[model samples]
Target chain A: MLANYGYSDGSGDYFITIDTQRCNACGACVMACPSQVLVTVDEDPNDPENDGPVVVAHGDRVRKLRYECDPCKSTANTTMPICVVVCKTFAISHSW
Target chain B: MSVDKQPEFWRWDETNWVNRDIEWINSEYITLGIDIGSVSSQAVIMCDGEIYAYGNMRTGSNSPNSARNALEFALEGATMKESDIHYCIGTGYGRVNVPMADRSVTEIACHARGANFIYGPSVRTVLDVGGQDIKAIRCDEKGKVTNFLMNDKCAAGTGRGMEVLSDLLSVSIGEVGDRSFDIEVEPSPVSSACVVYAKSEATALLRQGLNTNEVLAAYCLAMAQRIWSLLERVGVEPEFAITGGMAKNRGVIDRLCKKVGLEPMKTRWDTQLAGAIGAALFGYSLCRKGKSKRR
Candidate 1:
C-alpha cells in the first residue's frame, strides 16, 4: 500500500508517500526529518491486520507539510530532502 | 462585516439517537468513539460491536469541550456512565483533543470502517466531505483503507464553502437542496474552485439577474464537479457511500451521483456519526484483543 500523508491546498499538492511494503520501520527517515514530520507506529493505522512497526507521516504535521518542508526547498542547490535521501530502501517520496 | 441581519442559516439540527433493542448495560464490551470535526462533533457508544447510542452537534471553538459535550449529550437518559466504557477512540480533525479517549485514530480509518458498518460491507468507496476537507477512501470489506486521498487546504470542496454561499445568499442551509432544485433552468457552474472567487462569481450572477435558486444550482453543480474529479483520482468502485455534513445536501450529492453514474447507497444511521462509530468499533476490537488501555 502506498500511503499518502499530506493534503492538497490552494498552493499545490504537498504529500509524503510511504510505500508500506518497502519500509521496514528503519526510522532513518524519522530521524532525518528536520520538522519532526515522520514517526514510526507499532502497526499500520490504515491496515488493521498488518502488525509491525511502520513509518508514517505524523497526523498533526500533515496539513502543515507545505510550510514545514519549505526551508529545505528554499535552500539553493539542495537536491533531495534529508528524509528521502536517508531512506535506504527508497520507500519515501515527496510530492511538492 | 455586518453582523445584525442574518440568522444562523447554516445551523443544522444537533441530535442524538439510542437503539432501543440493545441492552447496553448487560454488554461486556462498551466502547466509545468521539469524532471532533472542524464544524461538528459526534459521539457514538457501542455495546458488543452494535451501536447503542450516538450524538451529533455543531462543534464549538474549543475542541476538548466539544468532545465532552458530545459525549454527555449521547449519554443523556441512558443507563451508562462515562466510567463504564471499556475503551474510547478519538478521531476526526480534533481527535487528539478528545479528553476521555484512550487512543486516537485518523478520520480516514474511522470513516472507512464506519461506512462499512453503516452502509454495509458491500460499500467499496467512501467519500466524506466534511467542514474543511474532502476524503476519498477505497476500502475492503473489513473497512480497512486500501487507498485514500485527502484535500484540506482548499475551502472550495468543503462544507465551509457551502456555508459561505448560504450566508451570502441568505438561504437557510437546510433549504439549499430543495431551493436549488426549484430553479427553472440549471445554469452552468461558476468556474472558480476557490471560495473567494466563487463568492465573487456568485455575487456577479445575482447582479446579472439570476435568482437565488439558480445561483445556488450553479454553485452546487460546481461543487459536485470538483468533488467528482477528486473521486476520480481515487478511483470509485461499486456500492459507493457518501457521509458527513455534505451528505445531507441533495444539491451536491444528487449532482455528484449523476456524474458518477451510480446512486449512493442510503443509510438509516446519521451520516455524521460514521467517524465516531468507526472509532468506537475500533475500540471494541482493541478491547477484544486484550490491548491495555492507555488512559
Candidate 2:
C-alpha cells in the first residue's frame, strides 16, 4: 500500500500528485481540483498532450514544509491514492 | 534725393525674411494623428494632400506604449523627425495618452472622419470591430457622428472571440478567414457567449468530428449575428463602411455584407489607421481655421 503524505499547513498548502502513466488526461482530476492547482499540461513545449499535473516544488521531498498541492481526489480502483473522495482513477491517497 | 534718405536695403532684407516666414507659417504643414485601439495602434502623418506615412503595431495590453511605438514607427517610415510634426491629435481608447496631441477626440468621431475621407462624404454608416469591442456608428453628410451603438461587455463578436476559436482549432488567426471561406456546410451550433465556454464548446465540436472550416464558419457567423444585432440598433444606411482590425477578416466581412444587404467599402490603406487619419484631418482643419483667424 502506498502511503500518501497529508499537508498540515493552515495556510492551505495542500497539493495533489498525479502519475502520468495512470492519467488518461480525461480531465477528471482537473475538474476535481477545487483549488485549480491541477492543470492539464496541454501546451507544454516538449510534450503538448502529456497527461500529467503541473507540479511546483516547494519543500524537500523528505521534509514537511508549506506547499501548495493539487486538490484532486483519488479513487481506490487503481494503485494510485485518491486525493478527493470522487477520484475515478483511485491513483491518489492522503497520508501524513 | 540724398543717399541717406533712401530706404536701406538691409532693412528690406529683414522685411523680406519676415514675409517669407509668415508665408511658410500660413501654408498648411503636416500634422500627426495617433490612434490606440484594443488590438493595435496606428499613427498617420498627412501632408500636401497625401498620407506621408502610416504605421500599425500590435497593442500588447498597453495602449499608451503601443501608441508611442506606432507614432515613432510612422515617423521613421516617413523619414521625418517627430519635431517636424506641426499639430498632433489623438483618438481611440488610449487616445488620452498622446502627450503632444492638441486635442483628443472620440473613436466614433475619428472613424466617421476616416470612413468619409475614403468613401466620400456620403457615407452614413460605419462599423468598427476591433480586438475587444465592436461599434456601429451613424454620421450625417458632414461626417459628424450622430447615433451610435457598441458592444463592450462580451467578447462574442470581437477580435478576442476569433482568437479563442483560432487557438481551439490549432490554426493561426490569419488562416481562419480563408478556411472559413471554404466551409460548405453550416457550422455546428455554438451556444456559449463567453470566451471560455465557447472554447470548450469548440473543443467538443472538434471531438464530434466537425471539420475545421465548418467550425470556423460557425464562429464567424456567430460573431456576425452579434454585430448584426448592434447594427440593427443604429439602423443601417447605404454606403456603409467597415473599419478596424477585424475588418480584414473576410469571413466576418462577407457575412456582414450578406446580413446588411449592402457591400462594405474597405480601402487599401490600413483599416486600423482610420482613427489616426481622422485625427490628423481634424488637426489640419483646426490649424487652417486658426491661421484664417489670425489673418
Candidate 3:
C-alpha cells in the first residue's frame, strides 16, 4: 500500500509531515519507521510509564524523508511498509 | 418379644435424642467457600469457629473447574472429606459456575465482608486489584456496601499487566514487587495505554539499552496511576484495605499510596481469600439466624 506513492529527492531537502488531528495515537508509524525517528509523547504525570511522544519519520522534505528511507523502500518491493499498511485509522502517510 | 410382637418402628428416647443432638453440636464440621476469579481461584474451609484450611491457585483459561480443584486441594490438605462439609459458598467472576456451592455472592459484597472481618468495623474503603479487574468500593459503618467503581474494560492496571511484564523480563511474578524496590532512575516512559502496545514500547526501550528494573518500575507506576484514577472517581477514604492478587505487588502498592497520598491498610491474612471468607461468614451468619428463629 505504501509503495503506490513514489518519493523523489528533487532538491535534496528532507522532512516528514504528520497530521496530528488525524492521529489517534495508534502507534503504527512508530513501529513502521525503520530509523526509529518517531516517538509518542507521554502526558500523564501519575503514569510515568505512559508519558512520551510517538515516533515519526525524520527529515525536512517529503521526498528526502520517504525516498531515502532505506528500510521501508527495501521492504516496499516485496512487502508493504509496516506503518502505512497497519494504519487502521489512516492517520499517517508520506507527504511527497 | 416374639418377632410378630416387635414394633414396626422404634420410638427414640428423649434422653438419647438430646445426647445425640449434643454430640452433633460438639463434632466439628468444615464448610468450604470457593472464589473463582478471573485470574485466580481460592478455597477456604471454616471449621469450629476457625479457618481449618485454604488454598490459592491460578484460574488459567478454565475458571469454574479451577475453583473446584482448588477447593478439593484445600480439603485434601486439611485432611478432610468434601462430603463432610455442611455447605459451600462461591464468589468472584466465575462464582456462579461453582456447582458445589449452595449460594454465590458478588465480589464487591464478599470483599467488603472479608476486609471488615479482618480489619474490624473501622475500614471504610476497599481497593481490590485482581487479575483482570480493579475495584474501589466504599462501605458504611456496618460493612454494608455503599458505592463502588470498577475497571474491567481494560487490562492495563490489573495483575494480567504485571504478568505480561514478568514474561517480558524473564522474571517470576513474585519477584517483580521486591525487585522494583532497588530502581533508582526514572524509567524511560512508555506511551501506550494498550497492553499489546505497551509490550512493544517496553521492547523498544530494552533495545535502546534501558535497564530492566527501570522499565518494570515504570510499568508499576503506570498501573498505579490507572488504579488511582479509578479510586479518585469513586472517592477514597482513610482506613482503606486492599485485596486481590495485585495487592501482593508492593511496588504498585507503594506507588499507589504515594499517588493517593495515603497508606493502605493491609493484613497478614491472604487477600485472595477475601471473597471466600466473606461468603463463608455470610453463610454462617445466616445459619445462626435460622437457628435463632427456630429457638
Which CAPRI tier for candidate 2?
incorrect
Which runs in model 3 stand beyond 4 Å of their true positions? A1-96, B1-30, B291-295
* lDDT (Cα, tens digit) per residue for candidate 1, span B1-295: 8777648877789998878888877898999999999999999999999998999998999999999999999988788888888889999988888888888888989999999999999999999999988999988899988788887767676899888899889899999988999988889988865677767988999999999999999999999988987788678999899999999999999999999999999988889889999999999888888774523
Candidate 3: residue B125 lDDT (0-100) = 87
- Candidate scoring better on DockQ of 1 and 2: 1
- lDDT score, candidate 3, position B115: 81
DockQ of each: 0.48, 0.01, 0.01
| Residue B160 accuracy (lDDT) in model 1 | 90
Enumerate the chain B TM-scores of all models: 0.96, 0.85, 0.85
Q: TM-score of the candidate numbered 1? A: 0.89
**Candidates' lDDT values, in order?**
0.88, 0.64, 0.64
Compose the digit string of candidate 2's lDDT tens values, residues B1-295. Answer: 6665632211100000011112222346777788887767788877733577777777657666777778777655244667777888888778777777776766766788887886678899989888777778787786776655444545568887787777667677776778897966777446644565767877777788888887888778877877786677568998898888788888888887898999887576667777788888877776776631211
Which ranges of candidate 2 are over 4 A from the true structure?
A1-96, B1-27, B291-295
DockQ of 2: 0.01
What is the lDDT for B135 in model 2? Answer: 72
Q: Candidate 3 residues A1-96, lDDT tens each?
A: 011112212132122434443556667667766766555543311111222443333323222444446577575464655666677776555432
True-contact fraction for model 2? 0.00
Candidate with top TM-score is 1
